[model samples]
Target: MYKGYFGLKESPFSIAPNPRFLFMSERHKEALAHLSYGLGETGGFALLTGEVGTGKTTISRRLMEQLPENTQAAFILNPTLSSQELLATICDELKIRYRKTGATLKTLTDKIYEKLNKNHQAKLNTLLIIDEAQHLAPEVLEQLRLLTNLETDTKKLLQVILIGQPELKQLLQRRDLRQLAQRITARYHLLPLTKGEVGHYIQHRLSVAQCDRMLFERAAVAEIHRISQGIPRIINLLCERSLTNAYCSNNALVTKKIVLLSAQEALGDEYQATFWWQHKAVKALAASAVFAVIVSSSYFLGQLYGENISEKSALNITAPAVNQVVSDTSSPAIIVADNEKIPDENAAKAITDNTAKVFKIESDGDKKRAVEQRIVKTDKPASIPMPVENSAEQLSNLADSKLAEDKATSKVKEKLSVKAVDGVSDDLLALFQSAIDDTEQDPQFKNSANQVVTPEVNAPALSDMPAWVQSDLPSLSFEQHIYTSEGESWVKVNGRDRYQGDTISEELVLNYIYAQKVILTFKGQQFSLPALSSW
Candidate 1:
């Protein structure tokens, strides 16, 4: 199709065994010389083996052209036949006719021997060339060996040439066929063309097709050789496909890119994997990227959720000092005071009213100071003497003392209010109050206070937990799972000591178990717990 466009007389890369287009390299020349030498002698057998499409038949045809005029050649294209059929076919090829129907093996062999003898008497060389001889049965090959035994005193009358793929060489190595192998006087294996020969081969064919200009670029030829692996048939296929592609694109000269595209089209999957990134390198890069993303995401999540907080920071906040008093001392003091005092309902009501007054103080500093003073005054040693006075007198005296203390506190507040106009002690008090308010409102301070005031034996406060821990994270944790040989499934949930059934809790139940994942229903919601391979 591309001949006229490329100034060629015909397609250069046709796979037909055309002698005019044969470009014999050194290997091909050597192979031809070997075959010629084998055929020249009165040989029992000459063997020629090559890989598929290495031009074994081409060399054989060339050998035929170089043979003398007295040569009688009988070609057997297919060797897949029984002993009788093979002999009959050989007789038919050599014009040694026999009974058309019901021909016994002996009858066919006798006819072939008669022809061989007649050819020898005429002083003519009789040649039997079997193509694809690898398919010949062992018994049929043995029969051929027996036919070779029909020899004269000087040399064998019938000459046999076996040309086939490399497997034919292996076939000859069989123990039963060792005798036949011993008779093979000459054997030659044909190898594919070399890289340099591939370029010369294309030019030779193009020249034979009557083209003068170079059609394939230098790099393009190298690429063709690489893709074809110096195999002539594969090179022809790739070059033809590349030429057609260049023709389709109206390209004047074929480039390496064109050759690459042709290889992908002609070779398909065999060449698809030739790309540098399609195999281990790309997979390794992708795996590295995935691992990096996972590690970075894990670190970011730990920081955001405070999961990476140091143990020292948590312990520092939780440890209490010896002199630090908690604000909830009123409960214990009231409980102790109530146990000690067995007074009437009126005195108890008076005490309760004073306690409520003390609690109602809004300023934390003033309240703390007042409570400390009251505790100090009321807390006397057990050995201290009690005042000898009536319960009403004692309660009245206590009430009178509380009223005097309140009046004194009011006077001090009034003095501070007057000092506010002067902006002396009042500003200091305001600054102190602001500092106290800020400390109380500070989250860190509150967290530390909560940790210190609460005993470690009690359950932790949920509010103090990290945000991600308190958030709606996946409820189920897959510690481990096992499947028995009989296919019974069991799993440990949340690293619990015992194995739970499919139903773990009233609200959570196992739904399905897979090799890499476990499904569960948590509070009527379905979720998946992925199996962690490592920490």
Candidate 2:
């Protein structure tokens, strides 16, 4: 309804988990890094704990997006079944076939071991990630612990990642579960967005939704942070409601008053309107008619910045029932699109808002071009023309003959009587001369005759810059180490070579490791790091 008014392609504040709208704060990045390391590193269990809607599932999808080709990962969203059933789920996820459907626990374990062993033999790493794992019974948890027992002399064969809410930490604290807790090698807690992060989160989603205009001002974001307590899910709910109210009221911006109205609609009658009315400071707002705005604003502001603490009784449980199939193995090999998005309520709303559902919206020329450009995947290389030696040569000769004829006719009619240099045709001379001045004046040109005629590099070729010059990066002196911080001495790049052993400097190592040269190594076997510099 307000598409034309605010000039948004879609509703920006929907609460859905669209990967395109994912704004990784410092904390979220750390959490993702921990999870990535846990799976990549050959070690014991990796545990991830976060409150409900704190983006655990989102992180899981992101991890899947980043997982290496050789690493076979099974994400179990529900783990409430018996030990045998759990084993079956893992097998199903890994697509490993087992003969015995009614196999005993020991027999099932043996099958899983055999499958994992086979996979390892094939040079494939298996990672079992169990989400919402707090609901796993003590026996089931112990069963998982037993699975990690299979190992080679150097490192463990099966790596497991257990993710759940904070209650998972509490559950692990039990005396009986202490043994399970001891094996966790890497652990990270995912916290809610900070006040600043909340504001960013809102804007990030809005921009992603194709909105250029600011829907929420600074004051409104602060109000949202207070009410939602910086929880992404709550923030989403409030924002969605606010947008709905704004759309209905024909408001261009989601003002502080609008956010409060949305909050009251979401929070219900328990919140005191009189409390806001009594507060002289809040009542002095420019918008007076929206009475609930002042009261709810104060109430939530108190909640923000630790003025009011959330209930400790609010337990976060990883119910086996929270089953979401984040990745479908059958889905086009699950390409993580440069602009790919995970289905979230926010994205869903954006879709609905942009489509001919709520309003009849017509796109302009730029909008149509933007949409067309998005359809083109520039990140991916152009398709290779299949090799046909005979056909290629014949076509090339035909083109050359035609070019020669055109040049001969042009030379006969041209004003310049000079013959084409070195059998180069007049067309070729004109084409080269058109841009010759630019290259002649280039400062990088060593000498006119010795000018480096660099091969026309494609996007894919230029993308390998870092990998080519990785070894050339400045190295740190031995004494300069000073143990700034402990980082993984080795990283498994593209699962081909494990760059292990401590570098004199982590920064220097990382800079080289993430270079385009190194990244292009994984682009395909068509090109490798060694061949990158030769170009």
Most lDDT-accurate candidate: 1
Residue 172 shift from truth in candidate 2, angstroms: 1.1
Candidate 2 lDDT over 279-354, as tens digits, reads 4335433333353466677658855623212232133322121112234333222222223342222111222221
10 residues in a row with least lDDT, candidate 1: 448-457
lDDT of 1 by residue, 415-441 (tens): 323224354576555653444333324
TM-score of candidate 2 versus the correct structure, residues matched by position: 0.51
Q: On a 0 to 1 TM-score scale, where does candidate 1 land against the true structure?
A: 0.52
Candidate 1 stretches with Cα past 4 Å from truth are 277-535
Q: Candidate 1, overall lDDT?
A: 0.68
Cα deviation of 229 in candidate 1 (Å)? Answer: 1.0
